[model samples]
Target: MSERVIAPKSRGFLFLDSHPTGCRRLVDEMWQAVPEPVPAGGEGPVALIIGSSAGYGLAATIAGLARVGIRGIGVCFEKAPARRTGTAGWYRTAATARLARQHGRDMVFLNGDAFSDTMKEQVAGLLAERFGGRLDFLIYSVAAPRRTDPDTGHVHASVLKPIGSPCTTKTLVFDDDGAPEVKEVTTPPAEGDDVEQTVAVMGGTDWERWITYLDDRSLLAEGFATVALSYIGSPLTAGIYRQGTIGAAKSHLEATARALDERLGKALGGRALTSVNAAAVTQSSTAIPGIARYVGLLRGVLGDAMVSPTGQLVELWDQLTGDGPLVLDEEGRIRLDTWELDPAVQDAVAERWSVATSDTVPELADLDWFGDEVRRLYGFSVPGVDYSAAVDTEVAWPTRIN
Candidate 1:
């Protein structure tokens, strides 16, 4: 008799025992739309991707191997396979490693907190030994609710509140019956050290630390490039996202890019930049107030115009490594949100937002698709997967875990 894997239960926001087949399918779709590029190096360009398990980080890692042919290392925090619960990231990372190998690429998915200096040092040391003390690229795409500072031993938690005043918005949440419920939310303005704490948790401090440590130790190759992801949305949710405590953090991130752009050039002829990404369905985004309903409506409005994470990544890869000049906005950062913010798209979204209600939402927004996207992020609701089949919750990860 053979042991079989069973579906794990969800503990609130956390889910366990992800479907391997679903994860593989999602990865396949991401690469299917991407055009493979010319191989860069024999072992591919040595690279590191922070927060490289799901969402943009996962898509970027897939694009790096399939499109850019980069042998990359990923840093993320995920629970290991357990008796009754194994994290979705564990399954995704396992599948990613297998896919990378099938493409004859080298990828190491490290399980640890990217906010920690210890993990950074471990990654730097590994890069030093494995790639002859040089890394060609680095990507920062971490999204965490809280962070514990290594130097000060202070824990900072991020808030999603607006900065100046209280505001009311409609947010979407799934009921116990798995049906969508539209809820009215009144959020107060951020006060006191909320902005500082949010920035401490979500800002560019850790990013700068990693770069300085690696560059100081001569781990970065000359002309190396680094990018961190940011989001600036439409006017509807601007108060909570673009102008909120998180926005303060993003501002710090952009400032870090400016400083590092000059510092990197001076240190090793390298470059540092932030890429403003388009909004999409992800584990992190769903929790944001009012973002779910907005994204659901946006999907309906944009339809074919909407860019998937992989699509954005393909464009990013081409722009960052292509033959033409580095295309950047006046702010010296790449703009990947142009399509999402198109007049036609935003006009439709704004129109829907004005008239949206629980009853009318079903007709206006593609909530079905929005729900599926969220499920798929956790390796559920994928096609061709037999939900009844037993799954191995004890599947081993082929990478180091700290």
Candidate 2:
């Protein structure tokens, strides 16, 4: 394959092509941010990270390898480079595998649909053969538009709409000049089985199934634990996010975590819980209606206090593997969004939300920083990356299972 300089091809927040070298640089920075590993008695923890290509999943994988010294297996679905550039997650995963090798850690990337029985079976066999047949931890961080039921073969698609009534909220849209412009977006309520389908796709059914499948094959370790990433925005975004169809799905996920906690407790002295993470610029979050505006305002208010997804997951590893007891909320979840939900932070964001306009929002929120972060997600505006230099896009995952 010949090398060529690849610029970002995006419409709104949807990016089509990714730069491999820039993605590798971002992965390297994330690895560098990881603190020194805590002492693991043996070969560290063996973990299975589903949806481990981008966002919190990718962060968790890096933290586990560099901070917790884990031997990990990652499962994600991504398109490889062909006529066009490959997806950002593809390059990120390959870079992470390379990082694992550099540190002499065992890491495997499986390129396939993680919500399928075949992939689950393949991971189980890999665990038995290559990972010593014991899984210490399972991290679930999948965010997809649709999911096909492994048992019934029904396709469920998730929708980002309100549940009861239409929601009209103030949001931000990038204009022709690449500056954020204030706009009002109205999303209609869920119709027919929209809520149910959203729940089916984004719910904890697949998470539960993965655990059951692995447990049936005796793959869980003595002190096994599992965590699924979730979010509960403040009342500002409640109408469209927390009170919407996705909220219904998140409710199911939390309930599943409780039930799994009970089951794991009785079976192998294990645990299951959800980690409510903070908002950040992610490919999935960009699709939500008011998330962009909220995140911008959040960054403006929180400023240096805002924690990136990688930082949050690094702290999570400390809490999970530390000597002290786990600090949980009233609902048995690890609250990683405390900073974002602080009263002072929310008050400031609300004040800006009330009076923000296309002309005034530039002064109220750090839209320029937000734009740079979004571009970095696609490996376009990362620091120290030469966009003019021709680079090969055909990067391969060194330990891909499929």
Candidate 3:
């Protein structure tokens, strides 16, 4: 008898994999939506955006420079080392670099950790030395689990919550029946190091490091501005984010922005701001423990209007270029996710939440479509791909990672 071996458990890594052609299609679609010529290079003024590998970081970088006529160099830390489905950042760098070259701009890729002093010094030096010590904008966004601190040699910890209430909630996963349903609360380590570690890497310290180093070297150009990314979701993710360790870190990041804004505004006649951004499922958002539930729920309500794997990217570009139709406060933090949490929407979700406990619970009205977008985000559901197409396991990347 022939033995049948089952596939290995996908673990969380499945979330990391991305389909390049789909992502490229998304990128191309976004690029086309920009009404003006995207220079593809921030040649004259210097701009820096970290965590520039995937999702918002990548989107913001592209959008900021597209119409602004500045050629920029992108630095990212990626594991898979190439422009393949395994490492989305690699694909982004590879594809973006190609566009840069074609557009008569310069794009360089530096692969490494943003937290270490070595990386910090390297980045700062690159700014000062590479482009004549001038920067017009800086974006500090680092999301990682751990980093070896170069300073006190201690791994600084990040806390995710106020030390008070511990909220818990329901989540969903496919059961043996091959159908999706709620799973009980996935309690994180009650003790709490992961949150702290995540906050340290993702929060404000690295952001500060980038700003201070660049400023000390007198690299900031006049009228320079900087922004850090943040999120405050509806109460659904309260247990996993706001009430969780990462939430604590986000709180720290928000407060730190206030602090940095004052100092940077004074010194460089520039500003350090916060963008409490829109929610879309990206690699970082998915790993936050119970986030898949929110992704599904949010998707069900808004459906395609909620998030488009490709068009939303154009939405980001529109926002960056001042052509966006959404409302924004003085801080420019557009509350895109807030509209989804209006009272009526929340009530509807609550009703669904109650039914979520049952085996026969129905799929949220727009869930399949929502899932379709999410799957497309990972390159699973794009048009024109034959599932049986042989994937080149030995595909070479545009730029090789170190």
Candidate 4:
């Protein structure tokens, strides 16, 4: 691997994010993707958006509100208040909420957990009081694996351990060498509390729970539409996600889509939609062991990866907002992950892996210009900043529901 200068982690270029203009560029791309106008600018119904702080939740809130004109309410589950600097989602939500409020949009922020009964009760009450129990959308966009199981009251931790025996494959970082390095990853088997526990935490249980409660309380609107995100990445994620406990849990989630479609579709006038969303580099995915380095090395191997230049993980975020060409709907459910798993793409990536090794330096061929984009997401690797810039450090949440 060639040594690129280590970039400091802090605000570098954009006012809020290093690449402010670059961020807008990505947003514009999303704006272009919704061929059918995703209407916005309204004050009619309510939109309960879980995980609206960052990731898909944030994109959904923006897209659904900006283009679709779902000018309803936004319910965010953020525990950033408990943390000093607050969560990344905190600032993103604040910036968007501020912009929305200035434009006469109805928006609300909450610093609470979405998996708790108390949180549910409070949000439900808010919706009832504000929108008269008329919520048109319920977006279950959360992606956390750590939650307290309501049934057992046990704090469950999701596992990424593979189901069967460990598997090994060649890893790619360089292609100059004629041969590749034989790298094997051993995924431990999840037994006892691992499998069941992981399922309880990441499966459709919480999603089902939320719908049942909302319906029982007569909170859902007549044409209510609900969507939950799911993904099955290519073999690149096999060592970490596939053949692991998390994979098992994901399977559980994938299965729930059908059942939820059946139940929610009937209840919501056949508008329950499940999208196996696109796969790209994500914050959560980046942090997983081996994935970060793999992605980094991939940037060198895949020449097409582009940098945001404005401190945003542009490509990944675009996919999350359903603003890309890869999304294809079968009936109503969208196959967003299909592109990531395309045989040709996977074959090309794997073939590169077979020919790359530590002894040889990899060339940028398939990677896009997404390096700066990925780095900007964490407020790093951006250009045109003092690096010693300062701030008041006294920003407050636009709305605190706790």
Top of the candidates by TM-score? 2
Candidate 4 lDDT, 269-310, residue by residue in tens: 645556565544555664454453355445554444322211
- In candidate 2, where is summed lDDT lowest over 10 consecutive residues? 34-43
Cα lDDT for residue 262, candidate 3? 85
RMSD of 2: 1.7
Reference-based lDDT, each prediction: 0.83, 0.90, 0.62, 0.56
TM-scores for all predictions:
0.94, 0.97, 0.82, 0.76
Question: Candidate 3 lDDT, tens digit per residue, 152-181?
Answer: 777765444433455456665554543666
As a whole number from 0 to 100, the lDDT of residue 229 in candidate 2 is 95
Model 2 lDDT tens row, 1-402: 759989887899988789999999999999888777644334888999998999999999998888888896999999999988889999999999988877777889999999999999999999999999999999999999999998789999999999889999988998766866888989999999999999999999999999999999999999899999999988899999989999999999999999999999999999999999999899999888888998998888877789988899988888888633688999999999998899988999999989989898888888878988898898888899999999998887666443
Model 1 CA lDDT for position 141:
95
Indicate the residue-level lDDT of 270 in model 2: 95
Off by over 4 Å in 3: 1-9, 12-18, 33-44, 67-69, 81-86, 156-166, 175-178, 186-198, 307-336, 357-362, 393-402
Question: lDDT: which is higher, 2 or 4?
Answer: 2
Displacement of the residue 122 alpha carbon in candidate 2, Å: 0.6
- Which is the better candidate, 3 or 4, if ranked by lDDT? 3
Q: Any residue pairs clashing in model 2, and if so which?
A: none
Better of 3 and 4 by TM-score: 3
| Model 4 per-residue lDDT at 232 | 61
Model 1 C-alpha lDDT per residue in residues 8-88, reported as the tens digit of each score: 355533455567667767777776667755453367788899989888998888888888888869888888755544567
lDDT of 3: 0.62
